[model samples]
Target: KLTAVLTYHVVAGKVMAADVRAGKVKTVQGSELTIATAGGVMVDKSKVTKTDIVADNGVIHVIDTVLMPK
Candidate 1:
């Protein structure tokens, strides 16, 4: 359960802020995450506070809320 929830916040590959699109993106947990780019970037119900934090494996986007897998 913890692993599932944790992986739900992760998306495969290095997705930069410029490449983000308004659509459903598949997470590492096998659940799809809805992305909205209207006023700002949103992952699920959480707002993306930060973007494009480069990591060794992939990029990280900070969200205001915790994403749970359905």
Candidate 2:
């Protein structure tokens, strides 16, 4: 049900934590996500574990936890 939201958090291109901090990115769901440094390079509550998984049409980055929208 919420998979769309989670997946949308990912960028279409390979975005490392370093790259993410440079700007605000749009999600697949048309929402905008603010990337910044918290306790660490945090995306909501999840820390990006793996990055730059290339697919035929997109990319995937693994996070340590799930993100719930408020």
Candidate 3:
């Protein structure tokens, strides 16, 4: 449960808003997240409401919905 949830929320590499293109990002938990940038960036089924929030270790993207593992 924990692993799924965490992996669902995380994607490998630091992705910036400008650098974000339509693709799949591999998660640490061994799943790939679908990323789309047609109108806006989406992580899985969740829409990214916010982006590029600088953190000490990495950047943060705020999603409108919680990501669940498949």
* Per-model RMSD to reference: 0.7, 2.9, 1.2
Question: Among all windows of ten consecutive residues in candidate 1, which has the lowest summed lDDT?
Answer: 52-61
Q: What would the per-residue lDDT of candidate 2 be over residues 6-25, giving only the tens digit for each residue?
A: 65675566654456573467
Ranking by TM-score: 1, 3, 2
In lDDT terms, how accurate is model 2? 0.64
Clashes of 3: 0
> Candidate 1 — which residues are off by over 4 angstroms?
none
Tell me the spans in candidate 3 whose CA falls farther than 4 Å from its real position.
none
Q: Lowest lDDT 10-mer window, candidate 3?
A: 6-15
TM-score of each: 0.95, 0.60, 0.88
Each model's number of backbone clashes? 0, 0, 0
Candidate 2 deviant stretches above 4 angstroms: 1-7, 12-18, 37-40
Clash pairs of candidate 3?
A: none
Choose 1 or 2, whichever is better by lDDT: 1
For candidate 1, list the clashing residue pairs, or say none. none
